[model samples]
Target: MGEKRLNERVLSPEEFVSGYQYITEYLKAGLPLCDVLKRALKYFEDQFVDSYCTIMLLNSKGTEFVNGAAYSLPDDMLEKFMHIRLFDGLGTCGTAAVRGELMVSPNVHNDRTWRSFANVVKPYGLKSCWSVPVFKPGTSDIVAIFAVYSKYSRYPTQRELDTLSAYNELLGLIVSNYKIDDSGEIEQLDLNEDDNLNSKTLYVESIKTGLKNGEIYPYYQPVLKSDGQELHGVEALARWEHPEKGLVPPIDFVDHAEEYDFIDWLDEVICRRACEDMKKLMDDTGKTFTLSVNISAVHIRKQNFAQRIEDILDETGFPADCLAIEITETSLIDNLTEVAVTFQQLKNLGVKIAIDDFGTTYSSLNYLKYLPVDTIKLDKTFIHDVDKSPIDRRICKTIIQLGSDLELDVVAEGVECDQHLSIIQDFGCNIYQGYYFSKPLTLEGWKNYLEQF
Candidate 1:
């Protein structure tokens, strides 16, 4: 026990065990993630008063977020704390992960450990720390982090560590229950209230707000030719420039939007914005090229979604041949035959389809044969290691051959260095996009960039 505990008086073993069991039962009772975290927080606070606690679980992207049902943090600062990643030398949680050891820091100011995050604790007047990685059930994959912060400098005693370990296992089950095996469908996970179906509707509204407020804009990354010197059309990536917060990357928020069934709105906003910019590009430069927009599986599942596409294309006055609709492997699965019929209508309208993030899913190749799409975007990973590995080269060659057989355009994404280009180009494949050509440019920024060179 710490000197603080010694002074506060000894904790009975039963009292400590009761606290752990209470946290366990609270988490195991199918409580939402936020509630579970909150209960754990309150339990520790009551058991050991004056202690502040946080539990962050891995978001879909394995990124940061305090499980909401669990943490009652201020919304204003939630993003700040949630953004703290668990990585080596990142912060207390990260340091603990790297060493695979329990971390206890009694001094916030003087400790050289995780000095980078000193600013985080300084504001809250927190000087002491304890963090442990909550491993996934039966696997070493870290699922979440349990952390304790105290306003005082005294460290945690052994009882706290033992109690937290069981709590972590219980939390992992909460997360595992919500894991959607559906590889690509947006999950409507209400960490606190899954019973309330209206929560998904609310999630949709948030994504809409993200769209209405200029939180979403197009970022253009140049596509390069085989020579690497020539620039082709720029890929219009949706960039979310949040008003209060700065840029929120797609990886950070896209799937969250998808989960709310508002992925339709995201597609609508991006498609509309891209079409508008495409018009401006033609007027400014007189150079016509293709702008591929990613389509969510949710939208594709709707038989009428194609009609919306037609309306937007007509409304924007962008050339039909100039736009490409990119769908993932899991798209249109809700009604496969119906999706095929819809694609035919799209093809008649002169709209093209390219399977986005291809090869991430095993069924992607199979999906292509069934749908009469015009393109296949080789996922970034294959392009990343195209030349280095034999298997990667074979996959690249296979995809190129497949595209050739289908008379489809095979586009490679995320080409960075010269070797990545050489491997793709040598395979006799055409069409590539990534930083190798240029990083994603802004709408006006892209226009100026193309005009300059």
Candidate 2:
């Protein structure tokens, strides 16, 4: 690392900031961003080697990642890479989208997260990477990314930060001006409300797409009644061991049911797997505990909701009392008044409801008057902030008090750190769930996880 060589390899702040301002001023002058990027690369080439840059503007819809422009990139490479929609491990652009921040991949080839896109991005000798978020002027929603690249490993200087600041502000203006069109984003499935969709039919596909193919399966996240560290229950988390696509997390496709009115099948699939696992666990360990699965509003609206549960419980030979149904307030609202009668029927059969994502909505508290839930699980958003924000602490405290006064148990979800544990312990919320104890694991995995206790 000689002085002049190091100075040239790493960006000088003054140079980077000056270059940043020139690009912004150019864009503000009404030049299309692609043209502006092209001009900026030309300017940088005349000045420094930090001229290789890519301006990735998000589609008008925020759903997918799109590579719109790359300065100094081969035209063919740009066109080919641009077609890649954003997803986890989907190269630099998609990783940035998921983390909601600019991730610098100084060497995209060696970074495990971006390894899949290596061949596509490595040919340019792109060793240095810089990505800065372009956001709406006063909002957190990131509209795009202005990624600066170099042929060597480069770190940002003060001048580089200044350049990024100006670049982001200018890019924000361009993004805010573009109108979002979400057409072609959602594909509608065929079949009517009365049609009992076949498991093989694409229309019947829910988040758990591979259950029919035997790839989608249940994993249990162990829940301990804190302090005693005793296994009280487990929630079934679904995973897709895709043959070609690799492992997929629930956040990736868990909403397909709510999105396509196919939630019922997803709920049923997870329920069946969870009940079967519970039965096996009881037989093996002789320690039976509750197993909770989420129920969708889509299934609750069906006339046979109660009978459906009975069928599954009997089929699996699992105790009806050893199960809990979790539902969100939004799902509760989907058919609240009508479903209340059905929930009451299930309650008579010893099924308890835990309101998931509680306190995330304003209407959650009021629903206690209408629903016969046995527990109110505090949403993690409030728990995450319990130590920092006074408002969140007060609300959580009030919620615990409310649930206690209503004679319903309060389970604090996302109880990660000891601070969260201490806080809830003070609030008399004895039951807790979160990654600190353990992340969601397969039933076989849970047996190993339980060894800690």
- What is the per-residue lDDT of model 2 for residues 66-168, given as tens digits with 9 covering 90 to 100? 5456557764565544545666465656677656675777677677867776676678777766666677644457777666667777665544554354345
User: Where's the lowest-lDDT run of ten residues in candidate 2?
Assistant: 1-10
Candidate 2 versus the native: TM-score? Answer: 0.54
lDDT of 1 by residue, 169-226 (tens): 4455455556522221223354465324223333333444556555687887776565
Candidate 2: list runs displaced more than 4 Å: 1-209, 451-453
Global lDDT of each candidate? 0.66, 0.67
Identify the runs in model 1 with alpha carbons over 4 angstroms from their true place.
Answer: 1-206, 229-231, 330-335
**TM-score of each predicted structure versus truth:** 0.55, 0.54
